[model samples]
Target: MEKLLVIGLDSVPPDLLFGKLLDSLPNTKRLYRDGTHGTLETCHPPITVPAWMVMMTGKNPGALGIYGFRHRRGSSYTDGYIVDSRHVSEPTVWEILGERGLKSCVIGLPPSYPPKAINGCLVTCMITPGPEKEFTFPQSLKNEVRRVVGEYAFDVTFRVEERDSLKRELFEMTKKRFKLASHLAREKDWNLFILHEIGFDRLHHAFWKFFDPDHPKYVVGNKYERIAEEYYGLFDELLGDLLEAAGADVPVLLLSDHGSKAMKGAFCINQWLEREGFLKLARPPLGVTEFEKAEVDWTRTMAWGWGGYYARIFLNIKGRERGGIVPPEDVPALKSELKRRILQLRDVSGRPMKNSVFEPDELYGVARGDKPDLMVYFDDLNWRSAGTVGHESLYLSENDTGPDDSVHSMNGIFLYHDPNNHQNQIKSMNAEEVAPTILNLFGLPIPDGMKGRAVKLS
Candidate 1:
């Protein structure tokens, strides 16, 4: 039986992996030289949660009903919920393998917080509130994890101003994560294994401006200029160790959920909506205010938007929302008008921003769950959406929620190395193709409804 190993490096962009840093990463570079590698086009919204799930299930975000990490619960504006393992209704690749009695070892996969039972060991992702809660499947694996690495770190606080402390914690978290992964690989009995390292994403968010000279906020003599290289080198070394533990014969799939790049700025979507008369506020906030906390005159508002890497615009339809105003019949024209106006929005410099607006039904054949009426990407996602109001200007130089320096990109990386048969091809692959490819490698049937074709390794 052939074993498969998947190393999911969250938010690792191809430019860094396939470009200048490749030479420094000897192990990864060897994979690049001998394996089939390319850019993996991420799903719509390009968020971590839905993107990973989409790859594992071969389903689009709409099919999974997950728009982003947080979702507006039903039609309530104020009520919202964070996604968890429970929200995943579709069967994952491991689950499909488990049915055939093939065991798996999954670690740090997003939305696996309330860790569910699998055929083998399982450790939840960063979303786990803390380690105090049960974070491992079968419960006993928690003891083994604690025995391996004292006090596991699911995530780190990267948005803080303490650069030195943040850097130390970031490296330490990744060290523990990979250490545990290596231990599991050597000890666990499994046909399929997966390890998702979120440190790369954190590193990009916290240190991109320091390393990337192209960043607007970059300074030539910044102290953290070499941070990206150091982190990548560390990751490559750890990856080499894990490969050794997993054995040289096992085929490896190194991929990322999404890519990252320096953020230009944040566009205050709510403030813009208020200025455009699409949203009505009962009273102006005295200071920066969250959209849910603001006094919104929902009765008069035509549409409102939630913000993150992208904007999720929702309409106030009559008979749908509590204080609905716009009639269902007027939704199409209203959406078209909103789309047109949003696309025409200009930057702070009076230059037009490259904005894209997509209707849920049009983008995804089926709109499910609490989907937004329209999705907007400002400046092709270089600019993030800010949901907060009370800002004098509609644009903010920093993230509305935190001090994030990077934004998610559509192109992540994909490298598949089969020691038995090396293709050495560089071709682009879609996110959905990952699962079907995995099933194919395992000699399993590519289940119906999986919207992807397996990559030919021969």
Candidate 2:
């Protein structure tokens, strides 16, 4: 079997690749010309954590029991925990490959903290505590990584409010990621190699404001206007180096968990819930507050929400929550009403903001752990969902976390290159199809329970 190489670029957009930055990204352009490429539809609420897992495990978030980075462990909102790879119940493609005695090198995929043992090396990503912690499989590779590259960056420091410092930090981190990935590609012999870079995601989040002049926060003549474009150019150069190391005969798969778009603003969902009488706070907040710390009156609160790139609501139901109020019989009616009200929500200009609201039962069609009653998108991905309740009005000035410019979009990029085939092959794909497709490339059976079918590349 030809060796399979998977390069995961978290949150890479097609517009930038094929449209905006194509001329300068020569390697990527050549990949596009030489192989099959298309938009890979991502999992809903397409953030890093669950989307990449979907690509690896070939399962939906509901089946995996991982909705996002932070998931509710119990019925209470306070019971939420930062999701890690340990939380994943399904075996990843690498784990399955390992069972088949195939050597695999996996690096820097999200929620990969506390690296799991693999047939080959492992480098944890995103929530890796720090360089001081154990971030590699053999434990000794962490030191070697640091020795080769001064500091192995799991993620860029993304507090966009600190623009000047963030630019310098992001560049340094991008270079370090490329350096480490190049070293690892040549350091070991493996049947499959996987490496995910978070720099594209971080760059889009931080500098999307400067790149898109029409963004509400975009500044004219900003020094960082072309930062994202330039980074794409640098990434192309890195791709050339890495491909040189991987050699000519290997089949390459380039993928991103999700795409990114300009964020208009944040919609404070908790505040909206309070206004709608579904949620109640014990006292007026003095300053910026989080839902878990807001001291809510659960006895009176029938429903409340927590926020992220999207909004997630929990029904305060009897027999479920600590101070349950909404009875079992009343559940459906309440959900309907909640959905109706959410649809009625509007932006500051009074234009309808919400794109759609989802119920896990309707979407996933089965019971899942710690499922949210409703999932929401606003203004078709231009707005973020804010979880706080202290705001004087429905809207907040900016993201409470930081000055974020980009929001996640459901469409990500996928490019497949086969050394033997030159024609345009499969044109479009889903995030789940990737794992099954790779398994098929190795002449392995697609797991019967997987939600996707392998694409025919011959």
Candidate 3:
């Protein structure tokens, strides 16, 4: 096939691709009618950059060495660059496709920072607190875009609180870029084309109340219905437009990095760690002390990120641990005690999380190389897990800071236009599966380091 178009619609739930929402755009519904639809499992922490990189690289965080967006850097500002092609442990599909001498087009791909010299068109998406201005695509194309597509608001940074504003900006931006991307898709004669709205993720974070039955903001009255109704309508319309603009022969693939869940509160996993004696609290002496370790207000502390993907808690160890503090002999007892503590996590109300943890050993390959030390699931909706190796805080305030927004885990949407061989059943593949799947799709050889199997779609 000469053409493949994938629209990675950020937080778009699978429901948006079918059911009542289908009525808005008959064309898209038809795509779903014949296409394979399913859910996608994202990586642990379900973060934007890490998930995208893992999908492209086909390696887990352990191999890639990427975990989250912002790490407390070691005092170097420029060194705090967001993850990108430079940081990715493996070659991207673009690089691989490029090697095959097939031209490709990529738009607004996250973690594509410090953009490499791709064989075809390349652009960065989800830049920190800013716009696409930080991108490193070819200057010829990058400069030509301003003149051809009209002025883009590159200063716009994605924020959870400014849900409405962000969507409006993204909606407009996506439309413009889609036009350019479509043009490139045709003019460049590329074998594969990737376009992303990324707005769907933000929309869900901000307006989940409109769609989620569990959300308090959900209003059945005619008034607030417009919020969810209009956005979905627009979503369908944009996708339809892209499908129509591209030559119909091109297969289209729609995906979300991860889904979201509505959050009720934060559960301090670290607090439970302290209670279990897994974490040794550094209490200050009662008398004068020049260096008092910052008081850890454990009750109000939390380690959170947009975590519908997953979280893990392992027995901190000495040698194998990222930074070993605990001795080797203590590891056995610590692992058992940590496992017990993880099962007993309670919300502010003291309810048990049971076995919300992913149990990587069972789920994936839980072997040393493939899994995190302690694998678990957080309150997927809004509650995320945070903190580094040894930090006192774990829980953060769950109070909705009014109209604020964030991409959460609930249900990521899916559709496979030409699911050649593998039935695109409503199955779920982790973020790690993407790298392998993409490589397999084009008949390219899989790289040596990845753990996931290529989706044999032939």
Tell me the number of clashing residue pairs for each predicted model. 0, 0, 28
Best by lDDT: 1
TM-score winner: 1
Better of 2 and 3 by lDDT: 2
Deviation from native of the Cα of residue 294 in model 2, angstroms? 2.0
Where model 1 places Cα greater than 4 Å from the true spot, the runs are: none
The whole-model C-alpha lDDT of candidate 2 against the native structure comes to 0.85
Give the Cα lDDT of each candidate. Answer: 0.92, 0.85, 0.59
* Candidate 1 lDDT over residue span 1-458, tens digit each: 46999999999999999997999999999999999999999999999989999999999989999989999999997899999999999999999999999999999999898999899999999999999999998799999999999999999998988989999999999999999999999999999999999999999998999999999999999899999889999999999999999998999999999899999999999889889999999999989999999999987899999989999999999999988999999999999999899999998888999999998888889878989899999998999999999998998999989789999999999998987887789888889999998999899999999979987654
For each candidate, what TM-score against the reference? 0.99, 0.97, 0.77
10 residues in a row with least lDDT, candidate 3: 300-309
Candidate 2 C-alpha RMSD relative to the actual structure: 1.5
User: What is the alpha-carbon lDDT for the whole of candidate 3?
Assistant: 0.59
Q: Tens-digit lDDT track for model 3 on 6-50? A: 888776656555654667766667767677667777765566756
